[model samples]
Target chain A: MSLVVIGTVAFDAIETPFGKTDKIVGGAATYASLAASYFYDKVKIVAVVGDDFHKEDIADFKNHGIGVEGLQIKEGEKSFFWAGKYHNDMNSRDTLITELNVLADFDPIIPDSYQDCEYLMLGNLTPQVQRTTIERLKNRPKLIVMDTMNFWMDIAMDDLKQTIKLVDVLTINDSEARQLSGEYSLVKAANKILQMGPKYLIIKKGEHGALLFHEDLVFSAPALPLAEVFDPTGAGDTFAGGFIGYMAKVGTVNFNNMKNAIIFGSALASFCVEKFGTEKIRNLSSEEVSARVQQFVGLSSFVIGQ
Target chain B: MSLVVIGTVAFDAIETPFGKTDKIVGGAATYASLAASYFYDKVKIVAVVGDDFHKEDIADFKNHGIGVEGLQIKEGEKSFFWAGKYHNDMNSRDTLITELNVLADFDPIIPDSYQDCEYLMLGNLTPQVQRTTIERLKNRPKLIVMDTMNFWMDIAMDDLKQTIKLVDVLTINDSEARQLSGEYSLVKAANKILQMGPKYLIIKKGEHGALLFHEDLVFSAPALPLAEVFDPTGAGDTFAGGFIGYMAKVGTVNFNNMKNAIIFGSALASFCVEKFGTEKIRNLSSEEVSARVQQFVGLSSFVIGQ
Candidate 1:
């Protein structure tokens, strides 16, 4: 079973307290594909980037065993670029610039070989585009997980809800969850959002950790406390990647499996923040990934009865 | 073994979005002692309240199997009264009034019978008072856990630091941890705070949960998410009470034991927020406490591959 990933593949300039990064490889699809590649071998990417994007970058996807047949290159255009500065606390950021070039009129084309995808990950994108991609699929994937942000809820809420209705799982941050449901209590927010469509909801709280809600069951995963969070640009995307990747690898969608997937996703995201814009995510070895997962096991694992 | 609790025992008026309460029995030591009573049988309270405090309030302590020998009742004076209003979020509050009458000239006199205490809980109070209680104990307790606030750190840094040095575990909120260590990252903040002499540190994140940090090892316990947080008053003190109470019951002071204590503490704190002041905590049964703790285990429990 293959895993399909769809979102932006673009350039990013990030400024954090630790340091600043020049325009480097970033985007929802880029981080998602890279993180998923670590767990699942048959990873397919459907994203649009400008001709300015170098060939080496495409080769990097191939090196990670990701299919590039669906990656489209628009001629005579620049890749989507985002510039943002993170506050001292690393919880909030101020967007400096968002230049959507090729992504403005982008279209996703799924390669015929990618038709067998069993797990679909819709990264943060225009809700309309997400719905279009879902409609384009020949057969609905066994599991469809979508990640969205407050931006869509603020502007294209109708489309966002429509897209949400088509997915099995939805992931968003804490404040976004509050905004979407108009409930300050996350438990109440999760309950309200679950009625809107997705069978599962994951509320990402950055350093505070992530919570997964399904029906009457809830699972909370803790974020590993690090001495520094170099950059948080692609951490959420990376988390989604690891989550879908693990599910695709295990070929299961049960609650127990999802719990483990959350841990795996959290472990991957922890590595993503140790450096800027996929730099840390790109070079991870199997041993490193295993060790990081162990850290999570240590961080949250406890036996009740002694 | 008996657990000795030292802190304010006073009256409080609380206002929350749910409702408001008149002069109810509420204080750090009051909450601490009551929470501890659920775990340990011999819980001794060393605090001073004025004559204005109700006779039935003292009876309530004895009813919970708590020792009132160390409790001093000052004649013809009002008890320390604090009025606070909880915001809509229920995570933060604003102090509306503070009337430190009986607590001002309060001298904590540890009764001779209380000298057999094995666990010591120092709830939020003046650093000098906490230090004095520690010094007054004829024999050092097996374990000392101290809780302090940012207020003390702001006005009496020297005394806070000195008192912190004498404790085995120090519990403070996330922002207070940052303020005390001058570091924004909790991991860095925990490292710096550990240097101040507490062998273990717990950075309580209110609704998010709590983190236990000790030399290179960390364990995170999530707070049980509720549909409503009616009131947050005395939750922290209740947490400390449960933690030390569990430790005293188990008669152990290792990382594993501390992990269980943190979970037990989190369970009790969850109930504290469900109702205003100590109403919920005051009427808990052992079965109810165990069931609450089971919820915490379910919320965070996950099994990875062996």
Candidate 2:
């Protein structure tokens, strides 16, 4: 069994208060698969890139034991490239450029070997494509987690709703959850969205941390507070990747497992933000990850005598 | 030993998206003392009210086994009255009126009976007044937790710093922390603020939750996600009250105890926002508080196999 992550594997130019990067390696699938590889060995990626994508970049995934059989590289077309500048706060950013080169009419092709996928992570993409990927799979994965943003909801509400109904878990930021449910209260927002489709909802609050809601149960994960957030790019995707990757490793689907998964995911995402793009997350040691997870444990653990 | 809370004991007219209230019995000392009463029995108040404050309002404290000896009534004068309206999100508010009648020349009178104070909670008040309260104590309290706001940092920064130096723990919202430290990063802000004097600092993030920072240790407390927030006024004071109250009960001052105190405080603050002013917190049973605390424990608890 394997964990299949499907999203864009392209280039990004990012600028933050600390510094700026020039077209570094970045993408939803790249970060997600790299994060997942830390926890689970059977991690595979299905993404569309272009000739501009270097072989060394693809080799990084192989070095981490991440499968690249489904990573499509177009012969002549350039890859999708995005450039954005983050304000001093690092919470808000302005998109300077978005060149959807090879991603415009790209089709996700799941290789035959990926048929044994037990966990599927659908990163931000067109709702139709997300749904199509699910339908095309020979057998449905044991768990499906989908992450989307406000952009899709703004233009494709109908399609978004349809795709949302197919996932086992849905993850979105606090603002997107508010925007999607039209409720100012996150608890109310979670309740409304739970009825729309997914059995569980994970509302990512960035620096504030993340919340996991399943049925009548809710789990709050604390974010590791850092003196400085170097770059927040791909933190969300990395979080989702780590979450499902942990789940696949455990081979169980329950509220308890999901809670631990969130902490593990938060630990990974914490590392993702310490440097530009995937620089911090690409070369993590197991000891470093475990130590960071322990930091989270210490960050929120408290005992009260009854 | 007693927990003496010093601040305004006046009237407030609050308006939220849910509804609005007339001039109700709302004040910093009132909320803090009432919340502290649940955890510690020897809770007292030191504040100046006016003739407009009804006998029943004073009875409310007595009913909770709180000492009112230090509560001085200024005859023929109106109690400090504040009117504010919360925005739709309930995070921001606009102050419509601030009538500091009796509170303008407020003198916190520490009663002889309250001389045994061991845990002092200086609710939101003038920096000079908070310092005065500390000075008036014959012996230094084992734990001093001061709650301040951006207003003091704006106009009386020098006085604020002097007062902050006297407290063991300082609690302020995120924005106030940023404004006082001139640092956008909370971790950086906490470090700067801690250097000023306080051994510990808490940056409250309303719906996001609260963080407790000490030396190099940090504890993140999860805020109960509510379906509706009837009113947010006095929630912070209530939190401070619960925190110091728990400390007094435990008779300990350590990071572990502080973490639990924050959770207990958060549970009380959660009840505070469920209704306007102190309606919900004023009458909470011990069983109810315990159940709420347990909910908090369950909300953030997770175990990972080593």
Candidate 3:
């Protein structure tokens, strides 16, 4: 049972209040796969990069025991590059550039070895692309979690809703949930989104926290309030990675296990924002992860009767 | 051990998107004492109102098992009246009228029968009055929880700071904590505010939740995502009352008890926002309160490695 991640693996230039970074290795798959590597082995990546992508970074994937057989390398083309500036609050950002050179006409290639996929994570991408990958899978994964954004809801909502119907879980930020459901109240929004297709809906509220709603039950996970958020570029992807990674490790798709997954996901996302890009999530030890999980337990646990 | 609440007991005209009310029985002391009375049997309210205050409204406090001996009733003066309109988001409001009638020359009088104060809640009043109540107590209470707003921080900084030093716990909203500490980050803001005097700090973030910070530990409580927020006027005061009231009932002030207190506080605040002014909190059953508390448990509780 292996986990498969599909998204862009490209370059990004990020500017936060603390500082700025030049063109650095960043993408939905890079952050997601890196976070997943800490929990599960034999993780496969199905993404497209260009010649501009560094060989050392490719080696870094091997270093983390991530399978790259499906990581298609386009010949003699620029990699997808994005540039954004985070405001002082770090909650909002202004997109400065979007150079989708290699990704514009990309095709997702599922490797023969990736047929053993038991868990699938469709990161932020074009709805048609995500749908294509889902259709390409020979055997449907045990659990499929898809993360999308308001951008798709704005542009390709029909296709997005079509893709959303194929997944078991849908994860999006709070406002995106509002935009998708056209309801300001998150509970109401979750109800409407759940009706669209997904059995479970996770509403990520950035710094506020994340909420998981499965039918009538709801669970809230708090974002660890940091002294300073160095960068928030990959935090959401990291959260999604940790979630599906934990699920793959536990080998269950039940609500109880999903609760723990959220804790682990929130823990990983907390670490992701402490540094620029994927710097903080790249080198987490098992001991550090366990300790961070314990911090979440400490941060949230309370006994009422005693 | 008794719980003492001190703030205003007057009339308010509130306008919200859901609805509006004219000259309803509302005030910090009114809401706080009512919420506290549900937890602690001996709840005393020390507030001033005028003859215009309904005789039936004063009797309503007695019906809630609240002691009103210290509620000074002035002759011929109008009760304090405030009029406010909530914005679309319900997170902000515009104060249309503030008539400080009976409260203008208010002198908090501690009733001779209420000397056994073990838990004192200074509920969003003039810092001078809060400090005077502290000085008038023959024996210092075991726990003193003070609730203040940005309004006081703006008009009475020195008095606010001086009174802040005298409390065991300080409850303020998120922005108020930032305003008091001159820090944008809540973790940094909490650290600076903790240095100012209070041993424990509760930063209430309406709609998001509340955060409990004591020394090096932090716990977050999520607000129940309601379909609609009818009014948000006295929710903060009601939260503080439930917190201190639970602390008094449990007869402890430790972190574990404080965690449950926050849950209870958040639950009461949740009810407060469901109706205009103090309507929802006027009559709540123990079963309803328990069920609400259990909803908080379900909303926030998660188990790992069961």
Candidate 4:
């Protein structure tokens, strides 16, 4: 019933066609923990922030039932920051700035209370941070899910490969899946990556939908077609959060259980795109989430002639 | 139920990386009727062929439960012929040869025997011919489905618009849907085109899968992932045949019934690509078709908990 999530908890500036936001509270761990918080109350979060990291932000997490005790704030440094501008297509964008501040040199400290958490989510971070966190765990959690960006694939593929072998499931976007497996056909890509280790491979196709591959079985869950997709910043992490969070709540890792989890993930992602990073998913009502999930369930269900 | 299908019935020379076929029997109607024959025996086919059209080739349709009484054999004329080469990516092809021959000015003549048909399938043809056939039907069929290519959208858009208003459903591929509606998003294109006429829209995604849109309901059926795709020439027509054919077999036009029909169509199209120019679909045993349908049924069926 407990979860520990770790990645970057920082700031971002995003410009999309709908509008633009300057220096919003955005980061991997921020979105992940918020999404997971909806399902679990014993959610311990770990991240390195600088003096600029708001104390009121920690208070907000505490109010949302997220344990912010594990967050380590360095007094004199600035937090990691990123800015990007989206194109008309909204699928591709250009990064305008990346300032690695406190994140440039950091060490993760897993708290004693977090050791007993049954679920562990590794948000996109350095391979060493991910590997070191696993090493810090006093006992193995029930399930470990990891996410990584293409940046690490280019610089630390070997380390990434080694870390991938340790997780129960690996979640990556379509481009990263193709880049990592060197196969354009996602079916082939999933099969190739399966040989590299993880038992489950979730290839996130963004707007297209996600493909969940386990052995010879593959399930595609379509993304909800919202009229507008404002900011896509944390949609992926939000998806990962809902996927693992629902699985942890149900406490079953069977294929059928994961099918519903995938739907839940897609529903959570649909909300993420309704507004800029974390705004929609953060305040999402249980009723709203349930309705959207039911819509997805309804779209694909029908009776057949006997 | 009796069905009448009219379109190209000619010769094609196609080459793919896997193999090549020289002057093989192909055409939109040729594949369409053959696929429909599996579900209904009394199927009438109409198409124009020339003196070069092989007698034995015409016999192939007759042997497959297709009544060729509506076929027009033009004396001293050449059979319509086309040649194309597929690239590694199956999404596109380059036409090497196209001799319009009998198809240059096709005017469909519905035989008295074909007048009793309850289902009408208008395969990809000139908009004028499609419109003429609709007018030629002595009695309106219970269900009419039409398929058209992008070429008609460019040259005979007005005729195509008129043709669209007369059919119950319209089938087109992804690119064709975009061109016909002048919309980039498939959902937007489908919405725009649906306003044009047909109550239902099936946008075939080739190897990826196909989408079925009716009113506000949409269902996606994935294509079977084959290791190799030999040829994709008549797959779309084969899909339409299986689609309308199953609807004929199911005896209803409800969304639930058409949902399964899409799966059957997808399964039939999957078999069509395993060999060149309808070779695989023609040789498929009932057991093989049932087995492939079962795969699609398995791939999409998953129950979720509340």
Candidate 5:
């Protein structure tokens, strides 16, 4: 009924062909909380931010039924800052700058008020921090879905592997799947990664699509072919939010139900990329999100042998 | 309804990690006819062979429903011979030898008995030859689906372009899609190719899957992941064969109908690579194919909230 998302709640300056944005409200917790809150009425965000991070940003999440009591504000410290530019294609991007600031010494502390959440979403973060949050949980959540990237993979593989072993599901892109599993084909990669610990593996292929693999079952969902993908940052986290959020609401762990959750995640992620940072996803209404999900359902549905 | 397929019917020696096959039956028409015959009862093939071509090779296409009538035999000449070695991946291969024996300067003349065929498949071949067959047709068949490769793309760009203008559908792989459209993104590639004349464009991604792009609508069919893929030769043509053949059987040409056709085509192609050349697909029965189609249906199906 509730989710506790542990990740960045910071500022991002993003540049895209469509336009440029000054430091706007962006972060894993920011995006994920907004996406998940659409389906799950209660969301608790546990993250650290600089004093400069706007209180209005906190208000935004609070308005969406997300509790910000666990988001720590470090005195005189700037928030985690990221600046990135998207290429013309928008599938791949180049990070221009990253200022760790308050995030450099982030010590996530789950507040007592948020301990009742039943679902967990660990956005791309340090493996150690992800593991610590899980150990601190008062009770085992119904499900834990975590997203990790190649950054921690290169430097903290040992920690990453340990962290991966604890989660119910793992989300990694195609290249990460290959990098982690050393398998060129994703089918092989999923099989190898599933052995690493997670019960389910979702291989996100950016503009191409995403794959859901559990044991012998596999489901593929294609990205909406939008005319423009202004910025891709946080699309994956937003997808994670939408996925866990929907699952929290539906309260189903069946593969058939999870399949719907992935599509919902994909729908939210599609909206996130259409604008810089989380601008497009921030104000997206449930009706709009539901409409996009329906479109994806339409795009994915086709009768065969009829 | 019956169909006519015209292309090389030849001998192939292939080496793969799974095992090696001595000179085995292969070629566009060989794979295409066998795959297409799965849908329609009778399929007549027009091709030329030489003294070296075996009687069993000729008998291979003799009907359970398929009839080999236009196969012209030339004495004192060798049959079209090809030898290739498949890599461990099976997606790439190196041609060890190519001896275009009686196929050199050969002319294809459809037998009078095969003229009444309602469907036609112009498998990958010389662009001029494909055009010539169309010119010789007594009446335009119900529908024509053509498959061509990148080799002709370099040598006969003009002829291929002209031939493309006449075909109802064109099937090519990702690289060919990029090369033909001069775009890296497949969506952009399909948009440009759709303007060239073919109402439908299917881009094959080998083991990944296939994309059916018509205007802005793109339907992706995930390939059935197999633990082993011995050889990938003829998979694309086999996909095309199943596609057009199923359509001809159902007698419809809508977006929804073609969607099923792509799945049927993908199912047939998935089996083609399980053995060397056409061996795996040769003895394939409708029951096995039905099971695979059900798997495809299961793999791509999902539900979304309204």
Candidate 6:
């Protein structure tokens, strides 16, 4: 069985307080698949790129033992490009440019050999396309974790809700959770969203950390506080990737496992922010990841006397 | 021998989305001492009120087995009164009125019975007053926890810095940490603030939780996510009281104890916001507090496989 990640595979130019970078390999699928490869061996990607995409970048995926049979490269068009600059706080950013040359009319195609999908991670994408990927699969994956942004909720909420109902887990940021549920309290928001279909809801609070809600259970994971966030791009996707990757490795779909997965995901995302794009996450030793996970254990562990 | 709480013990009129309250017995010392009473038996208050202050309110302190020997009753003078209205989010508020009657040019008189203080909680008051309390003590307490706000930073930063150096622990919300340290990153902010005076610093994030920072050690405490915050008037004070009170009960000052103390403090603060003023926190049984602490343990506990 394999873990399939479907989303954009494109280029990004980013600027942060630390520095700026030229067009580097970035996208929801790229970050997610790379993160998943660290935990699970059988990882595959389903995304559309362009002729402008470098050969070495595709080889990089293979270097991590990731299958790219579903990564489509258009012959003549340029790859999707995005440019953004982060503010001083790094919490907010401004989009400078968006050249969606290949992503605009892209179609996701699942490979025939990848039909035995056990876990699926639908990275941030159009609600309609995300739904189409699910429909095209011959059999539903054991666990479907879908990540989306506020942009879709703003324009295509009805379609978003429909897709949301099909997934087992839905992940969104704090403001997006507020927008989707129309509730100020997260406890109330989680209650309302759970009724909308997903069995689990993950609210990503960026620096504060992430919270997981399943039925009446809530698990709060602490984010590794950094002296500085070098780059925030792809951190969320990295988190989603690590989460599903760990799930696939354990082959479990329960609250306890999901809680551990969040810490693993948070550790990977913590490394992702130390450098631009996926530079920090692309090369992580198993030892380094284990040590980082321990840091989280130390940051939040406490014992009370009876 | 005792935990001395020094701050206002007057009245507050609050308006929240759930409801509103008239002039209730709400103040830093009142809330702190009450919360401290739950964990530490010998809790004492040091503040000034007026003849208008109800006799039953003074009886309430005694009811909790709290000492009010240091609480001065000014004859024929009105007590300090504050009125505020919370916004929809329950995070921001607008002050409607502030009448500092007995508090103006007030003198804090420590009773001889309070000379055996072992732990001190200096609530939100003028920096000079916070410093004077420390100076007047016959012997320095084993641990001193001082809480302040942005209002003091805006007006009396110089005095604030001087007082902060004398305390063992300092607690302020996230924004105030950023303002005082001139750093956006909380990790960096905590580092700078620790250099100011206190060996440990806590940046309170309200609903998000609280962070404890020492030299190189950091601890994150999760706040119980509530369905609704009826009133947030004295939550911070209640947290401080719970923290120092737990420390006094344990009879030790260390990182491990501080972590457990924070959990206890968070539990008390969680109950403080459940109703208008102190209605919810006034009458919690030991069983309820223990159960709430366990909920926090359940909310954040997770184990990673070896």
- The model with the greatest DockQ is 2
Which digits, one per residue and each the tens of the lDDT, describe model 6 over residues B1-306? 899999999899999888888899999998999999999899999999999999999998999999999999999999999999999888999999999999997788889999999999999999898899999999999999999999999999999999999999999999999999999999999999999989999889999999999899999998888888888889999999999999999998999999999999999999999888888888999999999999999999999879
Candidate 4 vs candidate 6, TM-score winner: 6
Please, what are the lDDT tens digits per residue for candidate 5 over residues B206-296? 7667888886677777777776676888898889888887888788787788888888889999899777788888898789999999988
DockQ of candidate model 3 = 0.81
Q: Which residue pairs of candidate 1 clash?
A: none
Docking class of 3: high
TM-scores of all candidate predictions against the true structure: 0.99, 0.99, 0.98, 0.95, 0.94, 0.99
- How far is B198's C-alpha from truth in model 3 (Å)? 0.3
> Interface RMSD, candidate 2?
0.6
| Tens digit of per-residue lDDT, candidate 4, span A1-306 | 488998899989999988899787888989888888777677889898999977777787887899877788998899999999998767889999999899998788888878787888999999899989999998888889999989999999999999998998899998899899998667888899999988999988776677788999987676665445778889889888888888889898877877788888888888888898778877878889889888777666655454
Worst 10 residues of 2 chain A by lDDT: A17-26
Error of 3 at B169 (Å): 0.6
What range of 10 consecutive residues in model 3 chain A has the weakest lDDT sum? A297-306
Once fitted onto the true fold, the runs of candidate 2 whose alpha carbons sit more than 4 angstroms away are: none
Off by over 4 Å in 4: none
Prediction RMSDs, each to the true structure: 0.9, 0.8, 1.2, 2.0, 2.3, 0.7
TM-score of 2: 0.99
Q: Which residues of candidate 3, in runs, are more than 4 Å off?
A: none
Candidate 2 per-residue C-alpha lDDT over B155-238 given as tens digits, one digit per residue, 9 for 90 to 100: 999999999988999999999999999999999999999999999999999998999999999999999989988899999999
What digit string (tens of lDDT, one per residue) describes model 3 on residues B1-306?
A: 689999999899999988888899999999999999889999999999998999999899999999999999899999999999999888899999999999998999998888999999999999999999999999999999999999998999998999999999999999999999999899999999999999999999888888888899998878898878889999999999999889999997799999999999889989999888888999899999999999888888877773
**Model 4 over residues B41-112: C-alpha lDDT tens digits?**
888899999988889878888888789999999999998999999987676899999999989888899888
- Model 1, A184-226: lDDT tens per residue? 8899999999999999999999988999999999999999989
| Candidate 6 ranges beyond 4 A from true positions | none
Give the 10-residue window scoring lowest on summed lDDT in candidate 6 chain B: B224-233
lDDT of 2 by residue, A61-152 (tens): 99999999999999999999999999999999999999999999979998999999989999998998899899989999999999999999
